[model samples]
Every structure is written in C-alpha cells, then in structure tokens.
Target: MQVKIEKLDHFGRGITYVNQKICFVAKALPNEIVKIKVTKETKKYIEAEIEEWVTISSYRIPEVCPYAKICGGCDLEHLEYKKENEWKREKVKELLAKFSQIEKVEVKEIKYLSPYHYRNKVTLHGAKNRVGYYQPKSKNLVPIDTCLLLNQKINELLPKMKRLARENKVQEIMIRTSNDEKESLIKISGDKPKSLIDMKDITGIFFQEEQLQGKEEIISTIGKYQYYLSIESFFQVNQELTEMLYEEVLNEVKKVKPKKVLDLYCGTGTIGIYISSEAEEVIGIDSCSSSIKNANHNKKLNQVKNIQFINNKVENVIDQFQQDTDLIIVDPPRKGLDKKTLRHIIRIAPKYLIYISCDPVTLARDLKELKETYQTKIVTPFNMFPRTYHVECVSVLVHN
Candidate 1:
C-alpha cells in the first residue's frame, strides 16, 4: 500500500513501482511515501489513487483548491508553483531525449506564467444527471461552484450560465468567452434547440451555431495587431500568453528573414497575418473551408496583402510548396503532426522550422523524426493552460 513516487509523467501523475511493476499514482508528489488504493492493475503497470500520505514529501504543499482531488480541472495545484516549473522543464527534456533522441537539443528553461486564472475558455458539459466536467477518466460529472483556471468573468458567470443552460433543451451547451470578455457567446449544438427565455440573468448573443462550423469574423487584438477570429476557428485560449507566444515565434521566423514562409494548420490566418510583415510572402494552409474564408477576411481586415490563405490539407499543398521557402511555422492540434505531413515538411527542407505544440508526447515523437534533417536551436515551453497538465511549447529547428 505504501509506495515511493519516483517521477512525474506527462499528465502530471507520479510514477512509482510496486513489485517491479510501474504504477501511476495520482495526487502524490515525487520523493513522497504515500498509501494508495489500487484502481487499476495491468501486466506492465498499475494505476492508483492516493489514499493517505503516510510520509509527506518536502515538496508537497496544501492544495489551493478544496476540490483538488475531486475536480478534474487542475493536475498540479498541490505542487508549489516553482517546483511545478522544474517538473515541467524535466518533462519536456525527458520527452525530447526519450522520443526524439536529439542529443544536443537545448531546452532553455520552462517559463512560468501566472498559474491561476490563466485560461480564457472553459467548456462545461450538461448531462442528464448533472452539469459539469467529467471526472478524471470517468463520465461521472462533479458539479462545482467555479473553476479557478477560468478568467474572473467566467468564474462569476458559471451559476447564471448553468441555470440558463438547464432551461435550454440541449444536453450539452458550450460557452466560449473571448479574452476581452467582449464577445461572450454560447453555442447550443446538437439537433435539439430549446428556448432559453426563462433565464433572466444571461446576457450576450446566442450563436445557435452548428458544430465544427464558422461564422462572421469576430474582432480580437493581440499587442498592436488586430485579428478577426471566426466563432469556429481555433485560436490559443490563453490571452496573457498569446502575445508572448506570437513574439517568440515571430522572433524565430524573423531570424532567417525568410523570403517565402508557410503556415501549416493555420486557423483563421491569425499567425500568418501577424507575421506576414516580416516575410516577403506568406501562405497559410488549412483543411477547413470556413476557416480559410475567415482567414481571408482576417487578411482583408488587417489590410495585409502578402499572406495567402489556401483551403487544403498540409500534405495536399506540400507539392505546391516552393523550394525557395525559407521558413515554415506549424501550430498543430494536440494530436500533433501526421507522418505524411511531417515527411513533406522534411522533404521541403526549409531553412527554419518552427513548431508550436500543445501536447508534449506527440511533439517529442515528431521531434525525433525531424532531427534526422533538422537540428533544434531552442525549445521554449509556454504555460498556455495553467493549473492543468497541458502546456504549449515552441521549438525552432534549423535545417542541418
């Protein structure tokens, strides 16, 4: 029952071995001896939930949230902020070394942003029995007063929003509040559209938008540049760190002064348009037709002519990639880049490759394959989703 946690995993769970079998222990800290209840057991490893801390580690601190264990919103709330940064830094290093085997890749340091209230979007689900996020790995929903990671406005609006949501006929209602808290829209997707007239507190526009669809451009600004983001377009959720992320990517892209730049998986052409001024010409590629349309609208809104938005898969447009491309920036979803797309980028062999990833495991795996043709110059980790296991990382690679 008593086990010593050895290290932290990608999902922020502690790793320990019981009888030579690895066990993923949740709510336990490294170098801590704790009693745990076996939740799952397999041939290779076991899964456990901490029962009690027989001997607490020095690194352990009282969690800020009373719902730390029950609520699935945060993973590292129990650990100290400084220690969290150290563990995250080690996480990226281990993933890169283990998956990519890139010997000399220098991960500068894991930058720490404000851990609390860093998230811009919180997607709350409404089930038949309850209304909240699903428990860790189970479908059981744990109702809560507020999620600490969400912005102050969203946290304040949860109860009213929940009441309004219950009045609606739809089972799942997703509320997305923009960074500025200017455009607070709720999408009641699904076949059922019910009247929300009973709720008196709920304000702002109701999108009534379809799932995986886009609408008219919504104006958003980061630093000096203003962007038009479609309701369905994918953008970084953290506002405080958005400018920092774009600056880091822009710094890397401008280092090469690329004549031609490619933005793959470009959603609404936010990044392409933001960095278009640095390059002679920029091209953005995406599979979403609506996203491409929004990207074009964004370009026109910004009055930028150098960046071109194309509606196509990254791999499909690989053939159209000019050999003279000097820089390529990719901001892929959590699944990371596919093998076909990664191979295409390698084949193109741009002078510089900038990859912005939200998942470390996939990023590590892709970096391994890319190291054969490119060398990493810097690996910068940004805290996009704080109070959670998710992290956004930027890796700049130069053609070898």
Candidate 2:
C-alpha cells in the first residue's frame, strides 16, 4: 500500500498512517510518498519495508551502502545528516516529555564532527568462514566488501582480515584503531588460538580462545591523557568526539570544583582520569574487571596520584560513597540505572551529578526519577555515531 511519510521516529523509521492504523516504514524519509510491503504487525502499529518510492523527498540522497536496508548496521544513513541531527535531539526531547513528564527541556545543539568514515572500530561476525554483520533482527549473516561507516584504515584491513578469518575458525573479529591512526588492534575470538597477523597498520593482533591474551598492549591518547585498552576493555567507539565529550566533562566538572568525586560506571576510568588533577581526589567504579584493570594501569601510566580504580558493581559498593564527595559522574550502560540503585543514588543527594548516557530513553527515565531531588541543569547531545540512530548525551543535575 502507498502512504505519505509523516515524520521520522527515534529509530529513524518513517511514521505514516495506512487504513487509519499506524505504520512504520523502513528506508522511507519524511515528506515522501512510498509503497511498502507489510513486514510485521501489532495492535499498536505495523512494520513495513519500502517496495517502491512514489515520490522521494528533496533531502533524500543516494545511500552509500548497497546492503543498507538488510545489513541493519545503520538505520539513519538514508536521512540527511542535518535532518538526522535535528531528529536525534528532538527524539531526546520527545522522550523526556512522554516518558518522564519533563517539558521544554533545553537540549544543546547536537555536535557532529564527521558524517562518513568516522568510526574508528568495526566488529565483524564470522560464521562458516564468511564474515559480516548479522541480518537485521536475525542470525543470518550478510557478507560485505566495504562499509562507509568504518575508518579508512579499518576499511583497508577488511579484505585482508576476511581472508585471514576465512583461514581460521572464529566467532567474531574486532578491529580498532586509535584516534591518531598511528596504532590498531585486531582481536579474533574463536575456539582455538592461531598465528597472529602482522600488518603495518596493526599494532596488536591477538586471538581470544577462552581468555584474552595478547602481545602488545593497546594504548590510545585523548588530549593530554593517555589510556591503555585491553582486549575486553570498553572504550568510546568514536575517537574525535571522545575528546570533545571529555572536554565538555572537564568544563562542567571544573566549574563544580569538586574536592572529592565519584565516577560511577567508569569504564576504563577515562572520564575520572581526565578530571583527576582538577579534583583533590577521584574514585572510579565499574562492573568490568578488565576495564578497571586498564583504568588502574592508565592511572599508573599517567603517574596521577589523586585517582583510584575499583572493580565492583556500583550498586554493591555504592554505600561506600563518601558523604563529602561533592560530585558524582555516572557513565552507565544502555539499560541505565536499576530502580533500587537510582533510588539509592538519588537519596544520597550529592551536591552535583553528571550523567553520560548513550540511550536517550533510559536517560530520560532516570532524569525523571532524579528530578524529584535534583534540578535539571544542562543537557548536551554528542554525535558519537554518525549515520546511525545512536546518540550520546551528557546531563547535569544539581541538588534541589
């Protein structure tokens, strides 16, 4: 059936009405009329795939990816970068009002550095010696020769890595390059370890069988600070904006002038370490042991004395939070804070709270809970992943 696209949703799907029922059409842009085949249906809405475009929007451009609709790695690449940024910030605003009853939230303009060839990392899934991402919402593999989202260096390594992966039995291959492009790390997960690949661009080539054991440690630098990344350590996917985001954190924390600070969900202690010197003391807590290990290594590598790293679930160790800790910076995973933990943290009522979130919906939900005891101060969105629906945001809350 043919429908007129109304607007884009948070996930970049075009919203329209068919038979007076809500419909979501993939690969359909706003202000365009398109014919779609119903793919899935529910009482709330029906999902569809665009079969033909009756009228394309003026903003629509040729997609760089041939397997875009099926690969599912990127959802918003079809939309123009300007429109994507506008919609992403608006999505955050809309979710805040709908889920959290927050209105007119002042979200800063979305910051986007590069729209293409910006990603510094790529993870390819391997099955039966073929490599690519799984088909959308399915386990089926889709082979690809190139991806416009990955860094040029990663793109250059794709064909060679594919050949190497085909020769070995593996589950997933992760390739990462440092922000400076002077170093790269390739980690292949499989049933058995194999000979490492020696390429000029790659600094560390490690195989993960039962555990992560590698030759050279993966080190990266952001501004004045340097970070050590292990095979399992979590780091920001976008390198350039990481520096920008950290600069934002530094600016905000410097204003608070925290004597004692707590960095909750501090993966690899990047944020804590970045602002450690500004504060008299900094404590970083994360659930991942590998990340905490790297965080401490980073602390020692940088020879900073004011910061400490702990490997434990934040909720389990949150009671140890010092009452005098003036500021708490939280960079949690997508699920956001659990109910019990959110309540506990809010009850503590730190003088200032900084939240770093990749998922806006969860962030809005947590903000709603925090609003009762804290006043929403600042919210800024960063384009961590361009050409994708994913967006990163930093929000600050002050005690009421």
Candidate 3:
C-alpha cells in the first residue's frame, strides 16, 4: 500500500488516511510517499511499517543508534530537533482537541533541554547473549551498544555493566546518575551480587533479588532537597528538567494560594516537598510502599513539619484525605488517573488542580473528564525528554 504522510502522530509515526480510514506508518515523514506493509489492522486505524520511501522529509536526519528502527527507547531520534518540538506541540493540540473538544489550545513550544546525553536513568533487559531495550512491543531484546538519550556517565558504565552481566547471573540492570555526575548507582535484579563490583565513578551499588529479598537503596539530592532512591521508587530521569518541572508545579501552587494541598501519585514526595513551604500543609500519597517511605524520609531530611507521606493508593484512600485540602496536584503514571479516582476527586472538588503528565493522550482524556467540574486554565509543555516523542505538560484546572 502507498500512503502519503500528512503529519507525525504522538509516537512520531506518520498519519495518513488509507482506504477511507487512518493509517499510522512508522519511519515515514510528512509530505512524503511511502510503500508500506500493514503491521497491524484495527477498527479505528491501521499500523504499517515502511517498506520503501518514495519521498522523504527534509527534516529527517541520520539516526545515531543502529537499532533505532527496532529499539523502543528513542522514537523521534531520526527527526531534526527543531521540527521534533513543533511536532510535539502539534500532537498535544491534536490530542486535546480530540479528547476535550477544545481546538486552538495554546501549547508552549517545549523548552529545548539538551538534545542528547540528558537522561540520568536507564533500564536494560538482559538475556544470555544480549542486553538492551525490548523490541518495540515484544519481549525480544534488541542489542544496543549505546543510546544517545543517556548521559555520559551511564554510557561509560554500560560496557562494564554489560561485561558483568555476561560474567554473572544477571537478569536486569538499572543505572542511575545524579545531576552533579558525582553520584552513580547500579541495581542488579536477578541474582544479588555478594559484593559491589569495583567500578570507576560509582557512588553506590544496589541489589534486588528475584525472590523479593535483599533490597538496597541510594541517596540522591536535588539542589537543597534530599531524596532516597530505591529499586522500586519512581524518580524523574532528567534532573535539570525535573527542577524546572517542579518549579512549574510550585508556580501553580503559588498562583492558587491554597491553604492545604494534596499531592497524589507523589513519588518520593519531590513535588510535595518542593512546595511544602508555600502551602500551610501538604499531604503526599503513593501506592508504592518504598516510595512513600522515601518520601517520609525526605520529609524528615528536609525537616519540613507540615508535610506528610501516606503509603496508600490515591484511589483507595481518597476518603482519608483531609477535608481541608483546597488544592490537588497529580503526577500520575503513564496510564493516568482511573475512573474511580476521578469520581472521588469530583466529589471532593478542590479549588485548584495541577496535573503533571508525561503522556499527553492520557492527560487530555483525564482533562476531558475533569472538565465536568473544572475549567481548563492553562497548559504548558516541557521538553523533558528532548530527542524522544514523549512530552511533559503542567496543566492547571480551576474548579467551576
């Protein structure tokens, strides 16, 4: 089948109509014609892989990764950075219009964080002979020597870690680096190593056994705040961008000036801790016990008395939230908020709601439902992950 690419989709895939239905073609560019073999067929849209490109966009550039087409880590690495950001803005507006019936949404151009070597965290899957990211949607591993998205320290550690994996009984390895580049942590997840392997520039080494025993942690600080990181807890991958992202949330808190705030899906209390001084009181909640523990530890580390961490799913513990909470900030996972949580939130109906979403599609979907009792205020997009299709947004929703 031949399809003329109209625009880039959220995943950086080309969008063009085929047979009176939309088709998403991978590795095709806008204003280009491509011969494609259908990879997937569904009622709504068809997915295809490019077989031959009759024409290509001028913005398409040389991909750094040899496995860029197959590896799922970096989706937009082939496109020029300038065009990539514009496509991201267009994608967000498109999703918002589709979900909220709101067109012409003002989407700020993503702040250009460094296009490469910005990622501070990377998780690689390991098999007997290969170790790298999973193939697009499969368990098969695509061997990778390096990823442009990772920082220099992580790239330096990759060879040694891969060598160790081949030598030891390794299932998975997670590498995390601090913004200062002074602190580095490596987590092994199949069989716990008896002792830390001596490596250059490593501050801490952690282990997590397959039987769910022998867990370890490392401490990392962002500016003045301290956060404990574990194999289980969630932490932002880009450190410098995270500070700006947190600042965005803090700015929202300042504008709302709510007396009390609820930070739902709060990971390690980073946002709550950052904005604790602004609000009279802040309550942070997450389902991960490890993250909540770290959050509480961070609360003590920061020595903020008004903030507290609750180790419970936000959806399950909505009734437990203090009635005095006039503000709510949600930093949910890629899946976004659930229906039950949304309903409970509507029942409580805080005066101001701030949503920090990595997935724009889910954010738009949730915002559509949130529009029931809330009015869309402002949405700002942050280029948290620069060379990828992922774009983060801070949306402020005001109570009606």
Candidate 4:
C-alpha cells in the first residue's frame, strides 16, 4: 500500500496511518511517499518495510557508510546532520510536553561536534567466519570492514580484529580506545589470541576472567580530569560531548553550591568527581563492582579528596544519605528510574536534582513523577550519539 510518512518517530522510523492504526516504516523519512509491505501488525501499531519510494524528502542525504542500511549501529545517517540536531531537540520538547505535561519547555539548542568517527568503543559479534554488527531486531550478522561512527583507531584495527575473530572462533569482541587515541584495549569472549597480545597500540587484552597481556586498564582524559577504564567499566562513548555534558552538570552544581552531593547510577563516578570541588563532600553509588573499583581508582588518579565511591545500588543506599544531601544527580540507564527509586528520591527531596538521561521517553515519564516534589524545567539536549536516534539530556529540577 502507498502512504505518505507523517513524521519520524523517536526511533528514527517514519510514521503513517494504516487502516486507522499507526504504522512505522523503517528507513522512511518525513514527507516521503513510499510503497510499503506490512512486516508485522498489532492492535496498537503496524511495522512495515518500504518496497518503493514514490516521493523523497529533500532533507535526506547520501549515506556515507556503505552498510548504513543493514548495520544497526546508526539510524539517522540518511538525514542531514543539521536537520537531525533540530529534530532531536524537537523530540525532547515533544516528549516533555506529551508525557511530563511541561508545555512551555525551554530546551536549549542541541550541542554536538563532528558527526563521524566519534565513537570510542564498539562491540562486534562473530558467527562462523563472519564478524560484524548484528542486524536491527535480529541476530543476523552483517559483515563490516569499517564503521563511519567509530574512532579512526578502531576502524584501523577492524581488519586484524576480524581476522582474529574468524581464526579464534570468538563469539564476541569489544574494542575500546582512549580519547587521545594513544591507548586501546580488547576484550574477547573466547580463547586469548596470541597474535593480538603484541598488537601495536593495544595496552590490554582481556579474555573472560583473565588478562592475557599488558595492564588491566587504560587511562582516558576528558576535560581536566583523567579516568582509568577497565574492561568492564562504564564510560561515555562520545569523548568530546561527554566533557560538554559533564561541564553542563558542573555549571548546575555551581549554581546550587551543594554542600553534600549524592550521585546515583554513578558508573565510574565521572560526574560526581567533576563537581567535587564545588561540594563539601560527594558520594557516588552504583551496583557494578567493576565500575566502583574503577571509580575508586579514578578518584585517586585525579587526586580528588572530597569524594567517596560505594559499590551498591542507589535504591539500597539512598536513604543513608537522605538527611545531608543538598543535591542529587542521577544518570540512570535507558529504562530510567524505577518506581521504588523515584519514591525514595521524592521522600529524600534534595534541594536540587539533576537527571542525565539517554532516552527522552523514559526521561519524560520520570520527570512527570518527579514534578510531584520538584519543579521540573529547563532541559538541555546533548548530541551524545549523533547519526543515531539516541540523545542525552541534562534536566535540572529544583525542590518544591
């Protein structure tokens, strides 16, 4: 059936009505007319694939990557980068008004840098002789030699890594590079490849529970702070934008002048440490032990004296810091805060709350609940994952 795409969804899929039900067409753009075949259907929505394009959007651009259509790593490669940034900001505003009931939202212009070769880490899966990213929503592997979204160092290492994956019969491989591009680490799920142990630029090679070569971590410098990242440590993918994101948080911390800061889902304690000088004391909590270990190492690496890292879930330890926490910053996973955690945060009701979110839908939903005890407004969008639907936001809320 032929349909004109009304707009793009949050996932970068085009939306139109089919049989009075919303249909999502993959790879279709706004104002584009396409012939679609229904791939799946349900009571709420329909999924379709574009069989033919009758009309094309002017905003669409030539994809720089050959595997853009098949690779699941990026979504908006067909859209112009300028338009992509605007759409991201509008999506954040739309979600906030729709889900959070914040109609007069003032979302700052989306911040971004170069759209290509920004990723510091990449994970590829191997099947038989093929090694590459999996197709979206499926386990099918698409053979890839290079990804435009990865750092140049990672793209250069792809050939060797692919060969190693094929020869060693490894099921998965994760490569991480430092921001300076001076250090690199590889983690594999199968046997340790002897060939990779002495690879140039490789500082570490981890196989399962053991380190095959070099040190256990690599150091990355973001802004003025340095962090040591282990194989299992969590760090932002975009190095430049991460510094900007943290700076945004630091600006808010400066305004609040929080005496005691509580950071939830702190990961490697980047945000807490970034704002430590402004606060009298800072406590960061995360359930990932490896992350906490890295966080403590980073604490000493930066010589930060006013911060402490705890290896525990925020929901479990939030109450302990309730009384003295002047500000609470949460950088939650894509699922956002659970009801239990939200309830506890509401009970604690710190003077200031800053939420850094990767998913706008979940962020808006949580902001709605947070509006009960906090004045929610002023969200700033960061193009953390350009060429993809993901957008990071920093929302500052003052206690009511």
Candidate 5:
C-alpha cells in the first residue's frame, strides 16, 4: 500500500495513520510516499517495511554503510545528519509536551563530535564461522570486515583480533582500544587457551563463560582521568568528546548550585566525582559491584570525599535516600528507567533532574512522565556516539 509519511517516530520509523490507527513503516521518510509491506497487524497499529519509495523525500540520501538497512546498528544513516539532530530535538520536545504536559522546553543545539572514527570500543560476537554485529530484528549475525564507526587503529586491528580469537578457539571476544593508543585489551571468552595470556602484541584476559565473568580490567581514559576500568564497568566510548559532554552536564549542575545530589546509575562515579567539589554531598548508586568498588577506589585515588558510592540497584537505593536531595542526576541505560524507579523519582521530587540518555526515544518517554510534576527546563543533546544514529541527550527537569 502507498502512504504518505507525516513524521518520523522516535525509532526513526515513519508514522502515518491508517484506519485511524498509526502505522510504523521502516525506511520511509517524512513527506515521502512509499510502497510498504505490512509485516505486522495489531489492534492499535501496523508494522511495515518499505518495499519502495514511490516518491522520495528531499532529505533522503545514499547511505554510506553497505549494511545500513540490515545491520540495525543505525537507523538514520539515510537521512541528513543535520536533520537527524533536528528530529532528535523535536522528539525530545514532543515527548516532554505530550507525555509530561510540560510546555516550552528550551532544547539547546546538539553538540556533534567527530562523525567518523569516534568509537574506541565495540562488542563483536562470534558464531557461524564469523564475527560481527547482529542483524536488525534478528539474532542472525552479519559478517563485518570492519566498521567505519571505529577508529582506524581499532579497525586495523579487527582482522588480527578475529584471527587471534579463532586461533585460541574463542567463541566471543571483546576488544578494548583506548585513546591512549599505546595500550589495548583483548578479552577472550569460551574456553580460551592459556597461550593467549603470553601474547606480546596485546594485553589479554580470558573468560570461560559470559563476556564479563573472567575478564579483569578494561583500561580507559578521559581527559586527565585514567581508569583501570572493570570489564563490566561503564565508561564513555568517545574519548575526545566525553570531556565536552561531561562539561555540558556539569554546566547544568553548576547553574543549579545543588547541595545534596543523587547520582543514579553512577557508573564508576565519573559524573558524581567530576562535579563533586560543587555539591556538598553526592550519593552514587549502581547495580555493578565492580563499578562501585572502582568508584570508591577512584574517590580515594582522587582524594575526594563527600561522594558516597553504593553497590546496589537504584530502585533499592532510592528508598534509602535521605529525602534532602537537591539535584538528581540519572543516566540510565538504553532501555531507560523502569516504572518503579520512575515512580520513586517522582516521589522524591528533587529540585533538578539532570537526565543523560543515549536513546532519544526512551529519554523522550521518560521526560513525558517527569513533566507531570516537573517542568523540562532544558534539553541538550551531545553527539557522544557519532557516525551512527545513536545520540546522548541531557535534560534538566525542575519541580513545578
């Protein structure tokens, strides 16, 4: 069926009404008439895939990546980068207004990092005689020679790493390359040979089972901060741009002059410690025990106090909060905060909520919920992960 797409949904899907119900069609752009195959039928909406663009939009362009449509790694490669950012801003605005009922959110210009060669790390799976990312909407893996999103040094090393993994009879391997360039980590999982431990070209860690089980450190650095990152720990990928991103988030905190701050999903206490001096006390909570231990070690290493790192789920820690939190900084995973945590945040009702998210769709939906009792004062997106459709947005919500 031919339909005129009216707008881009949060997932970059084109939304058009059919029978008074929304239809989400992939690979269709706004103002474009496209021939679509209805892959799904549901009570409220239909899911479709674009068979052909009957009339292409002006914004449509040739995607650079060969696997653009199938890789599922990026959805906005066909659209202009500028327009993508604009759509992201609009998505945030729409969510805040529609979901949160907060009006007039001042979304700042999206800060773009290096569009290419910005990624320092990538997780490549091993199965069916090759290693690559999983295909879109399927567990089927796509064999990749190299990704343009990674640094040249990392890309240059993919083949070698793959070879090393195969040679060691490894099923899954995660390569960690850093901005330092001098050091990199190769984590081999699934019955890795001990000979890999003596490899001179790479610093290796072995895992018998899951990716995170046996691996030790994932060394990473941002600005002057050098982190002996735990294998399962969270750290920003784009090194050069992370400083800029953190500065913008800190900029929001500085303006607020928060006394007691609650840092949710505080991976290794990066943001909490970075802005520790400004706030009188900062409490950081995360589910990862390794990350919390590192956060505590980092606190001692930096000789900074007044920042408490707790190894507990945010939901559990929320109940223990002193109810005197002036600012709440929440940086959730791509899935975003669960309903229970969202409810808890509303109950706490801190003066300011500095929300950082890598997924715009979730960020928008969460902001909508927060807008019930809070006003979205500012929304700023940082291009932490460039050369791809992924974006990291920061929203500041203040109590009404």
Candidate 6:
C-alpha cells in the first residue's frame, strides 16, 4: 500500500492513516511517500515495513553503521542530526501539551554535542558465539563487531570481548568507559576471564560480587569534579551532555540560591556536589547502596563539605528533610516518580523543584500533578542520547 507519512511517533516510527486507523512504518519519514507491506494489524493500529520508496525525505541520510538496519541500537541513524534534535524538542512540547495541560509551554532549544561516539557505556548480549543487541523488541540477537555510539576505547576492545564472551559462555557483557576515554571497566555475567586482566585500557573487571581485576571503580572527570563510578552505579551514559545537563542544573540552583537542597535519586551525588558551593546544605538520597558508597567517596574526593549522602529511598526519608529543604531536585528513572514520592514532594512543597527526566511521557504526567502547587513555564530538552529516540529534559517548577 502506498502511504504518505504524516508524522513521526514518540518512538521515531513514522505514522500514517490506513483505513482511518493509525499505521506505523519504521524507517519512514514525514512527507515521504513509500509503498509499505503491513507486517501486523490490530484494531487500533498497523505496523508496516517499507517495500519501495516513491518519494524520499530530504532529512534522510545514509546510515553510518553497517548494521543500522539490523541492530536496534540506533533507530534515527538515517535521519539528519539537525532534524533529529528538532524532532526531540517537538516531542517534548507535544507531550507537555497533551498530558500536562500546558498548551503554551516554552521549550528551549535542545542542547547537544557530537552525534556519534557519545555513549560512555554499552551492554551487549551474547549467545552462541555472537554478541550484540537484540533485534528491536525481539529476542533475536543481531551480531555486530562495533557500534558507532560506543566510546572509542570500548569499540577497540570489542573483538577481544567478543572472543571472551564466546570462550567463557558469557550471556551478557557491560562495558563502561570513563569520560576521558582513557579508562574502561568491564562487567560480565559469567566467570571472570583471566585474559581481561591483560587489556591495558581496562582498569577494572567485575564478575558477580567479586572484583576480578584492577580497581573496584573507575573515575570519570566532568569539569572540576571527578566521579568514582562502580559497576552498579547509575550514571548518565552520555559523558559530554552529562556535563551540560549538570551545568544547566547548577545554573538553576545558583538562581534559586537555596538554603537547603534535596537531591532525590541522586546517583553518585553528581548534581548535588556540582552545585554544593551555591547551597548552604545539600542532601543526596538513593536506594542503591553501591551508588551511595560511591556518592560518599565522590563527596570526599571533591572535598565538598555541604552535601551528605543517604542510602535510602526518597519516599522513606523525604519527610525528614521537608522542613529544612527549600529546593528539590529529582532525577527519576524512565518510569518517572512514584505516587508516594510525588505525594511527599507535594507535601514538602519546596520553593523550587527541578525535575530531570529521561522519558517525556512520564515527565508530562508528573508535571500535571505538580502543576497543582507549582508553576512551570518552560522546559529545556537535552539530546542526551543522539541518533536514538530518547531525550532528556530539565524542568523547573516554582511554588505559587
């Protein structure tokens, strides 16, 4: 069936109407006319693949990765980088208007860095002597030797890592590279591979609960601060944009000049410590014990005296700091904020609320709840993950 792509969905799939039903076509761009073969059909929508292109979009570009079509890593590889950023900003605006009831929201221009080689970490699945990501939403693995989004150091070690995976029957391998791209850490689900010890760039190798080689953690330097990251610590994957995102947060904090700041879901205390000088006191909270351990170490490493790390869930300990904190910064996971946490935040009602969210859908939902007590006029989107559908946003809410 010939279809003219109307617009792109939140997941970067092109959308068109088929028999008045929404049809989604992968790799099809807006204003492009393509003949598609319907792969699946349901009552609500249709899924299709392009069979032939009648008109190609000017925004489409040749994919840089050889396995772009097969590997599910980079979905927007065919779209121009400039258009990709624009679509992300629009996505955030669209979500806010649809879900948050904020019709006239101002979204600042997206902040981005190099479109490629920005990811500081990658997790590859291994099965039957092959290592790569699963195909889209399927369990079938697409074998790949290199991914364009990975740091150069991790890409260089892929061959040996592939061999190690095949030899040791490892099911999963996660490699993290420091911000400087000089140090790397490898974590595998199988037994410790002794050969990984000799790799010069690999500063740490972890298997299960044991550290098989080198140090227990790797250091990532961002601006003037150096963060010690463990295998289990939850740090942002994009190194360059992380600094930019945190700098945005720091700027917002400086404007507030908060007396006491609460950093919820504060992994490794990066943001709290980054803006420590501007606040009289800062408290960081997270559920992960290893991340809290690293957060304390980072606090001392940076010689930050105003911030304290708490190894507990935000909902469990947020009430204790309600009376003292004037500002709250929450960096929630993809699922967004929990009800209990949101309730606690509303009760606390800080003077300023800074939300750093990776998923726009959930961010909009949470913002709707926050709109009851706070006023938010603008949200800033950051292209933290380029060549992919994911976008990060930083929104500030002020108490009415």
TM-score of each: 0.92, 0.95, 0.91, 0.96, 0.85, 0.98
Q: lDDT per residue, candidate 6, 283-375, as tens digits?
A: 999999999999999999999999998999887887675456799999989999999888888888888999999999999999998887888
lDDT of each: 0.78, 0.85, 0.82, 0.89, 0.77, 0.90
Q: Tell me, by TM-score, which candidate is best.
A: 6
Best candidate per lDDT, number? Answer: 6
Candidate 2 TM-score, C-alpha based: 0.95
Clashing pairs in 3: none
lDDT of 5 by residue, 302-379 (tens): 788899988888987686665588899999999999888888888887888889988766776787777677887778
Clashes of each: 1, 0, 0, 0, 1, 0
Report the CA-based lDDT of candidate 2 relative to the real structure.
Answer: 0.85
Worst 10 residues of 4 by lDDT: 190-199
Q: Judged by lDDT relative to the true structure, which candidate is superior, 2 or 5?
A: 2
Clash pairs, candidate 5, are 100-368
Candidate 3 local lDDT, residue 267: 88
Cα lDDT for residue 53, model 3? Answer: 83
Worst 10 residues of 3 by lDDT: 209-218
Residue-level lDDT of model 4, residues 1-400, one tens digit each, is 9999999998999999987999999989999999999999988999999999999999989998999777867889999999999999999998899999865667999999989989999999888866899998799999899998899989988988877876787778899999988899898886566565456778888887788888888889988999988878899999778998899999999999989998899998888889999999999999999889989999999999999989988878776655567899999999999988998888887889999999999999999888868887689999999999999999999987
Q: Write the per-residue lDDT of candidate 3 for residues 1-400, one digit (tens) a residue.
A: 7778998877888899988889998777899889999988999999998899888889989987777778867778878988888888777888888987654456766665778888889988888845788876798988678888888888888888877777777778888876666677777777666555765677666666332233255676676687876656799988778888887788888888889899999988989998988899898999999888888888888899999888888888997655577999999999999999898888888999998999998999998888768887778888889877889998888888
C-alpha displacement of 2 in model 6, angstroms? 0.8
Candidates sorted on lDDT, descending:
6, 4, 2, 3, 1, 5
